[model samples]
Target: MVMSRRKTKVNALLSVLISLGILIFINVLNQSFFKRFDLTSDQRHSLRDASVEIVEELEDPVFVRVYLEGEFPADFKRLRNAVKQILDELRAYAGENIQYEFINPSASNDPVKKKEMYTKLSESGLTYTNLTIRTKDGVEEKILFPGALITYRNKEIPLQLLKSTNRVPSPEMMQNSINNLEYNLLSAIHQVTQTRKKKIAWIGGHGEITGLDAYDMVEHLAERYTIFDVNINEKLNALIGYDLIIIAGPKEAISEKDKFIIDQFIMKGGAAMFLVDGLQADMDSLQSQNNMMALASNHNLWDMLFNYGVRLKRDVLMDAACAMIPINVGKFGDQANLKMFPWYFHPTLITTKNHPISANVNPVFTQFLSSLDTVGNDKDIKKTILLETSPLTLRRMAPARINLNTVSIDPGFEKNSIGKTPVAVLLEGKFKSLYANRLTPNIEQDTLIAFQEKALLDTRIMVVGDGEITKNYSNRQTGTVYPLGYDKFLRKIVYGNKDFLANAVDYLLNDERLIKIRAKEIEVRKLNDRKILAKESEIQLANLALPIIIVGVFVFIILIIKRRKFS
Candidate 1:
């Protein structure tokens, strides 16, 4: 018996030593090498190759200050946890270069101090959301700013953790926010770490929408790019320093010289976006004047665009899937009865599913948009439809008359729009010069010219048939421009023009891979409410009693083993 007891003690000591040795070995290996395992169905925890590369090349530390801490709802808790996990993952790859801390903006009870902090956060470009909380005493309101600030080197960028999409409740918004966490964090890091800013120019001489009319989009683009108002004015080198040029909704025709300059720019591997209005239709004119007629406007770029592989039709698209405008229907003396009616001329363009620019994007609202058709058999030129009108759409060939009196008259329009009509198109590849074999412009021979009849390098072009897609509405009274894609009367987002335009810009600027990250999808698996309600008692019992039962069984098994050993 004595010999057996001594042998058992020796075995126990050996087992303990072996376990310690194994743990120490694991620690030593982890210090030199790092690996992470993600077994999720969608691999939500995995980082993109671009993200990994950016983090690995970090010469300076990135400090992230997240303001999503403190006691909150379960959904917010999940979001906070997700942010923590992504930061942790970034830190793993970035090593000591990634630093982060969670901050509770409302932690202090002092009102003055709290107000001061709120001002600071707001001044730092953080916005807040008002949330209502209920308790036994009464209902109270709390303001929460679900945002973060990331700093790298001398630059910093603000990230709104909770993206507000079409106004929704916290549960749905939180889930959407969680889905976008990776993209938001990664994009912010990229922006802060980026040392160079690309130059973007808006073509000015072609009578395009300018100043406050294009304020919202211009402001958004200015965040990451240096914007310039450029005019060709028969200058060959007008577009020399520009990485990309946007011909946004030009009202007048482009001159031949200007077209040649643009064509030569494309031939030399420069990118451009043409937000041209194919048909002349104006909502302001309809509202102010009695005669409502739309004439086809030739911006003189049709030949150029056709050569580039797209033909923008001189017609307006009317769709059943459209926005509504309030109409006054009461007598002159009586109280005006305002009723909402569908405006067929303003169709909401459906986003394409496969393309990164349109994937998972909301419908883009367009006014007087024209249909686009691909031209030419150039195998080098590839065209993809990015946005289209829904199947319930019909094209009204210009000179089309728009009457406001038709709002009350229900002339049953058939669903002729059975097929998707392309409105926005992306053209990419080696483009053949439009000016090839055509009369050369009158210029001195000493001028520097690329003179490439075909594309020297692969380039991209985006053709949006409606220029209104880039226009923002301003309050008539205050003269304040509303955000792009926002509808003030309906108090809801009618389209995603801002995101669509931004993505197009990014794609044209040669940030395709980074923009493609916005297409990442995360499936939200929700419990069946009906089933949960039906078996509420059973679920509660299992949750409450199962833990106790497990503990009881474990303790019982331990007691039995002890007794057996003693015996």
Candidate 2:
């Protein structure tokens, strides 16, 4: 009996030890396994990982504070959710190095505390909107503002306006805004993480579109790159220093000398983007109220592109879908709903392909667009279509006139025969220069830059047919800027066109890091209403009794085994 009792005790002790060991192992495995699984959707996963990289490289911790007051508007819930999700992701990925906080000024109804918070937010350059709501008696009103402030090493960067809720939300707008957040936040982080800024050059002169006209686009890029506006006319030596050059909408013909300089710059393996207008349109008369239209075959730069297997046609493209504008034909007396036809110039919708540039871009609008014809097939060059017209598009040869007053839609506009046309194309690979054998032009050497070589043979180039499509012309009186094609403000900005431009620049600079960031995917989860309704009672019962039942079953099994052994 003594031996049997001793044996039973030993067995019980061993079983308990084994169970404890199993429990410890399971707990450790669960913690480590959950860490590897990013519960965020694909889009958020990319963003979170990118944020992690930034935070991990931080020599010091950064603090981010979000301030949203009262109950958020229904429409703004998505923005709030996105911000929260990003913040949580950052906090998780940042480990203990980065700290974040959310502040609701309304947490305390005390006026003093609220005022102090408002003052601090204001000092930090955070923007807020006042939400006015009437009281029970309809006399009193209240206001609220929600914003975010990021602080690093005592420096505070406040994001006053998270998003705009006045207009309907668009995917492009949301993506663009999120991208802005990524760019701005990452750039700030990079200041501490990186040792130097990347160099990017904008090629000027040769009647190229002025950088002043591209202020907004350049400003956004300046956040990440060291932007330099180079007039290649003074010297070719300066071109060698820039990692990339942008030929933005050159109107005048490019001289052979300038072409040589550009070619040499490319030959050095420098990337470039050409936003050239196929049929150059002069607004000189239109702005002066003369309503005169002129088409000039001034983009001779195509000579170089032609040698590379890409040709920019001079014909203007028209689309059935276009923008509408109200014009007064008779001075303030008679007004007509004459469609400005801005939208139809062919709105290039974003393609869901794997190309980094067009990914997540909204539809882009183009006006007076020309077709890009591939010339002299070169097996070495790889061409991709970045923008194309709708199937209901037709080619209208230039020297076309735009009369806003008597502008009548062609009754036969839909009948015109033209298949889907390509407006923008991306070319990569080896290229031969048109000025390979030609001597440099002696057109006033005063501003001429010398060439180092024929051209960068292996380089990437993006060519867009219509420059006016991206141009925003505003009336000085109303201060209302007219979008290139569509009247929808959100549509104009979100469309793939702007994203394409930005992405093209990013790609040319070989910044694959940002390209990867653009490929994020959002995971949406919807509630299963039917299952919830059908199994409501069953689910409730399971919730209440399942754990108890499981515990009882285990206890009973243990008791039965013990009793049998004892008996």
Candidate 3:
């Protein structure tokens, strides 16, 4: 018996040493090659390969200051947990290069100091959320900043935490924001560390939109890209240096020479975004009277577009799902009583989910929007519809008469739906130039023009039929520009036009890895409310008594086994 006990003790010691040795060996292997295993069914803990690669190549430290540390509700707590988890994962890959801190803007009790911190954060581009919670002294209000400030070297950028289409901070919105936390972090990191900013040129001199209308987009984009206003003036190589070009709401017709220059630019693998308006309709026309005429105006680029693939129709569209406009419903004591009415002309557009460009975004807003159709069966070019109308849609032909009273007296609104057409599309592939066969011998032979029949590399071009999608409202007197998609009548920003435009540009510039990351969806499981309510008593009894019963049985069995072995 003494020999057997000694042998058992020796075996236990050897087993412990062997386990330690295996652990040390594994640690040495891990130091050389870092790897993480995610056992989650939904891969919630796994980061994308592109994100991992980006984090691994970091040469400098990126410091993140998250301002979500104050006392908040459970949903916000969940968001904070998600942020912490993602940052930890990134740190695992980035090592000492990734540093972070959780800062509570309201940590200070002094009012003046807390207010100063709030101002500083807001000026640095973080949005604040106002919450009302029931305290011991009635209901109290708390302001929380659900955002982060990422600093790389001398550059600091702001990233919102719950960045999604839903304006309301609901539970569903929180989940959506959590699903996108990884993409948001990695994208901000990549932007702050870029050695050179991309170049974007805006085509001018065609009565295009000014900086006032596109202030939100222009100002926001200037941080990541070098924007320039260029007038081609029929020049051959005017747009050769730009990575992307924007043509928003051109009023005048584009000359043939300028069009040819743009064609050759695309043939050389340049990306372009065209926000054009096919109909001449505006709010000013209706202010003079209750009725107005919608006419199709030609910008003289139809032939070139038809050759490319899409035919921008010569009509306007409407939908039962549309935005509201204020109208004079009645008067009281010589005062005009303005009430909100659904303006069919201003359709709230539904985006497609198959493509990452428009996936997981709220409905886009458009005014006096037109439609388009894919014409040819070009196998070389792949056409994807990015935005379309809902099933309850209707159309108005050019010269169709419309009146404000139609909102109330329309016979067929949602019941007799007629239209569901593509309003925005993305065309990707080698594009055959519109001027391929029309160029003269001298023009073709000129080296400056260097016209290629087909595109040198696969490229992308996006066309949206409504220019208002890119235009932001501005106060004429104060010179203040509201955000893009801000509805003047509703006095709020209730649409996702800004997100759609930014995503479109990201896809066009060959940065689709981040977009795919943004498209990841985390499954949200919920309990059955009816079943829980029905089985409440039984569930309570099980939760309160089952653990004690199991522990008693386990203890009794262990005691009995010990007694038998000793006996």
Query: Where in model 2 is the C-alpha error above 4 Å?
Result: 1-16, 27-62, 69-81, 104-125, 134-161, 165-192, 203-212, 237-240, 282-294, 327-354, 376-380, 401-416, 430-434, 439-458, 475-496, 519-567
- Which model, 2 or 3, shows the larger TM-score? 3
Question: On a 0 to 1 TM-score scale, where does candidate 3 land against the true structure?
Answer: 0.83
For 1-567, candidate 2 gives per-residue lDDT tens digits of 999999999999999999999999999998787564556545454454555677666777777676753565553555566666666666666776667676776677788987887787778777666655456677544445556766767565555434443344455455445545555455455543445677788777767655445565666577568898887774557677777888777776777657777777777677878778777655445546745564756857767778767788877666665444344444543644333334344445445455877776667756557789877777878898877766777665767665544245562556774867777788888776555555445522334444333343567888888765445445557655443233453434334454567777888777655655655545446669999999999999999999999999999999999999999
Q: lDDT for every model?
A: 0.84, 0.65, 0.86
Give the C-alpha miss distance for residue 469 in model 3, angstroms. 1.7
How far off is residue 560 in model 1, in Å? 9.9
Whole-structure CA lDDT of model 1: 0.84
Candidate 2 structure, TM-score to reference: 0.73
Q: What tens digits encode model 1's per-residue C-alpha lDDT throughout 376-482?
A: 89999888988888777777788888887766665345735546788889999999888777755643232567577889899999998998788888775788787
Stretches > 4 Å off in candidate 1: 1-21, 24-35, 69-79, 104-123, 127-145, 162-175, 331-333, 405-418, 441-445, 525-567
- Identify the superior model by lDDT, candidate 1 or candidate 3: 3
Report the CA-based lDDT of candidate 2 relative to the real structure: 0.65
